[model samples]
Target: MFIPYCISLYIIKGNKSIYDPAFRLFALNMGFADLEFMALVGIFPAVSYFLPFPVSFNVCKVFGAFSADAWFTCIMLSQMMSLNRFVGIFWPGNAKAIYTKRNTTITLAFCWIQGLIWTSFYLKPNVGLYFDSKNRGLIYDFRLNGTETVFSLNMIFNYVHASSLCLTYGLIYLKIRQDITEPYRLTIFHHFIPVHDKKDVSYEDNILEYKEIMAAPDLNTGWRRKHMLDPKLANDRKKENKVLIQACVICLLHVAAVATWAVSQKIATAKYVLFIPSIVGLFSSGSTGYLYILVNSTVRQKFASMVSKCWCHKANQLSNYEARKKDSGIQSISPKKDNEYSELMEMDDYENVTKN
Candidate 1:
C-alpha cells in the first residue's frame, strides 16, 4: 500500500492530479509521515528481531522515541488536513487568504518539528528493554511505569488532538446542514444524531471550492484575505457531499479501530487477545495509505493505470525478448538518438523501481 500509493502519488502529481494542489501536497505529507512511522516500528523492529544479538537498550529507546514522534506527526498532519478541509468548506474565502503555499509548507515542517519536541521529553527514561531469547533480539516497552505520568499526559494530548479533529469536522457538518435547502432526515441503526425534514431536493450543489465564503466585514483590519477561484465546476455541486461521506468513513473506521484498545485496557489479566488490538492497529496503520485510493477515484484510476502499464510491459518484455530488443533499438542508432533512448530507458527504470 505504501509503495504503490507513494509511487502513484508522484506519478499523479507529475501529471497534475485532478484534486486541488493543497490537498494533493497535504496527502503526500501524510503518506511520508505514515511511511516513516511504519518503517521505524514495523520494518526496523522486524530486522532487529532477526539479528543474532540484542541491540543496546539505548538504541532501542531512540528508535521507540522516533516511532512515537513519527506517529505523533501523522496524527497532527491528519488534523491539519481535516482543518484545511473544514476551513475550505466552511470558510473558503478565508482559506484562500490564510492557507497559502508558504504557510502550508511551514505547517508541514512545524508538524514534524513539534512532534519530535513532544516526544523528546520521554525519550531518556520512559522505556524498558528486554532480549527476546527466541527472536534473538531486543524488544522494548516504550511506556515505562516510571513515566506513566508522561504517558498519561501524552494520552491527554492525543485526546485533545482527537477532540479538535471532531470539533472541526462537526462544524463542517453543521455548516453543510445550514447550506442545504432541504432538511433531510438522517437514519442510523447504530443510534447517532437526530433526524429532520424540510423540502425534498436533488443532491446537486454549487459547491464553491469552499474557500470563498463571505469575507468577514473587517477589510480595514486586513483580516483573512480571499482568493478568487474559477467558476464552479461540475464536481463542485457535490463537494460537501463527498466530504460528508469521507468524514463519516474515517470517523467510523477510527471508532472501530480504537474500540479494541479501550476494551483491552480494562482487564488486569486479559488473555493473549489483549495483544490483538495492537496487531489490528498496526495493520490498520499500514493500510491508512490505501484509504486515499478508496476515497478518491481519481487516485484509484491513476494507480490502476500505473500498475497495468508495469504488468503489461513486464509480460511483453518476458514473452518476446528479441522483439523487445528490436523495439528498443528501432527508436535510435545515432549517438544523439542513443542518448535520448538511454535517458528514456533510465526514466522508465527509475519509475519501475519506484513502482516496485
Candidate 2:
C-alpha cells in the first residue's frame, strides 16, 4: 500500500507525458490488492495466533473468500504489468494506441469483476474451506463437507495465482534475455570491424565510437540501435534490466513457495511452507515502486524534497515550542551560544521570510 501510494503520488506530481496509464492502473490495483491480502490473510492468521477466543468457522470462510479475491486481483494486475512492459518494449509505436488510459482502466475494472465472480463461490454459509487444520478444525465441517469436489473453487484460485505468477516471470526472463543478448550482438559486431593501424586507431576508441554511432538513430530509420554499443545507453539499459530481473526473481520465489506448499498438502503433510514465501512475496511486490525510484530522476528528487519538507516541518515545530518555553521563563536558555543552534535559527528565519 505504501509502495503504490508513493508511486501514484510520483506519477501525479511528476512528468505526465512519460507516465503510462497502464502502469498507473497497475499501481492502483497493487495498492488495493496488498491491502486486501494483508488484511484478510496476514492479519487474520496473526489474530488466530494470539487470541484465546474460539475462532469462528464462518470467519475462516470469509478469510478464504477475501484471500482468493485479493490473490487473484494481484496476479491479474501483475500479468497486466508484464504485458504492458512487453508492449512498450516490443511495439513502442503501437503501445500508445493499444494501451490508452480508458482501455487500461476498463481492463482493470474487468479484472476486479472477474476476481469478485470467483470469490462469490466461497460466500455461502457452507463453503467449508479450511486452509489448515491447526487454525481451523472439524468445527468448519458443514453441509458442503462431503458434497464439495476435490477440485474446489479455492483450489482453482490457488492454481491460477501460481500459474499467472510463473507465466509473468517467464515472459520477463525472456524479455530481459532478449534485450541483453541483442546488445551483445552489437558489441560483437563492433569488435569484428578491421583496423589497419590498431595503434593510431586505438581499439578502445574504435569501440567507443561504434557505441556512440549505435546509441541513437536518425528519424529516417525506424530501427532502434542496441544500447550495448553506447556506454551511456548500455548503463541505462543495465539499470532497467536490473529492475526487471528483481521483479522476475520475486515472481519466481512466489511460484516456488506456492508450489512447495501445494506439493506438501498433496502428500498429506501438515507443513505450511507457503507462509514464508507469502511474506517474502508481499515484500517483493514493492519492487515496482523501488524501480520507479531507481529509474525516474524526477521521482527521486520529489522523494528527497518530501523527506526534507517533513524534517524541516518537525524542526520548525520544535524550535517554536522552545522559543515559547524560553519566553514564558518555563525553560532556561543555555548560557553557551552553540554554533549549530545559531545556524539552525538563521536558517529557520530565512525560511520564514521566504514563506511570508
Candidate 3:
C-alpha cells in the first residue's frame, strides 16, 4: 500500500502524461494486492502466533484463502504489466489507442473479480479442511487436504505466468538488440557505398536536409530526437537493457525459489526451508517496482521532489511552531504593559512580512 501510494503520488505530482495509463493503474493495483496479501498471510499469522489469543482454525483458513487469492491476482497483474510493455515497444504506433485509461481500469477490475471468485470457492466454508493421515498436527488441515488441488491450480497459473513473462522478456530483448544493431548496420552500409567521382552538390544538400529534418522534434518531443540520434538512442536502450536483464534474472530466481518451495512442501520438509525460498520470491516481485523507477526519469525526479517537499514542509511546520512558542513565552515573561505587547505584535508582523 505504501509503495503504491508513493508511486502513484509521485506520478500525479510529476504531471507526466506520457506513460501508458494501463501500466500505471496496474502498478497501483499490484501495490494494493501485495499489501493485502502480506497483511493476510504474514502479519496476521505472526501476530496470532506470538499473542496468546484463542485463534480459530477457521480464521487461519480464511487468511490463507485471501492470501492465496491476492497473490494470484498480483502475479496476473505482473503479467499484464509485461504485456503492457510488450505492446509499448513492439506496437508503439498503436500504444496510445490500445492502452487507454478506461481499458486499464476495466482490466484491473476484472483481475480482482476473478481472484475473488477463485478464493471464495476455495474458502473453508465452501470446502472442508482436510487432515493428513500421518503427522496430522504438523500442517494445517486446509493445506494438507487441498495440497494437490491447490498445487494443480497453481501449476497451471505458474506455467502461464512464467511463460508469458519469458516471452515478453525475450521479445523486448530482441527488439532492443535489433534497434542497437541497426545503426551499426547502417554505418557499415554507408561505408560500403561506392564514392562517385562526380561532384554531386545536390546529394550533399539532400543529406544535410535529411539530418536537419531528423533533428527536429516530433509529437513526442525529445523522445523522437533521441530516437534519431544513435548515441542517445543507445543510452536509452542501455537503460532498458539493464532493466530487462535484471527482470529476467529475478524471474529466473523466482522460478527456482518457487520450485524449491513446492518440492519442500511436497516432501513434508521443514517449513523454514520452504520459507527461505518464499521470502526470496516475495522480494523478487519488488523488482517490478524498481524497474518502473529506473525506466522513467519523470518518476525518479518526482520521487526525489516528493521526498524533498515532505521534508521541507515538515521543517517549516516545526520552525513555525517553535517560533510561535518562543513568542508566547517572551510575551508571557514581559511586563503586562499594553505598549510592550503592541510593540511585540508589531515586531512579529514585521518579521512575518519580511519572511514572506
Q: Write the per-residue lDDT of candidate 2 for residues 1-356, one digit (tens) a residue.
A: 45454654555444543345676667557667866766666566767867887567667777777676776677777677767766776777898999987898898998898788767765755565444436221112335754254235445656776787677667766766786666664554445443345557777776665555455444222123455234455545654565466456656655654564445434333345445444554554444465555555545555555565577687774344455676787755653323344345445644553344
Model 1's lDDT to the true fold? 0.58
Query: For each predicted model, how many residue pairs clash, with residues at least 3 apart or on different chains?
Result: 7, 1, 0
- Residue ranges of candidate 3 with Cα displaced over 4 Å: 1-15, 124-147, 183-250, 286-295, 308-356
Tens-digit lDDT track for model 1 on 210-230?
A: 112223323332222111111
User: Cα deviation of 323 in candidate 2 (Å)?
Assistant: 18
Question: TM-score of every model?
Answer: 0.65, 0.60, 0.65
Candidate 3 global CA lDDT score? 0.58
Pairs that collide in candidate 3 are none
Q: How many Å off is the CA of 205 in candidate 2?
A: 21
Candidate 1, residue 80: Cα displacement in angstroms equals: 0.9
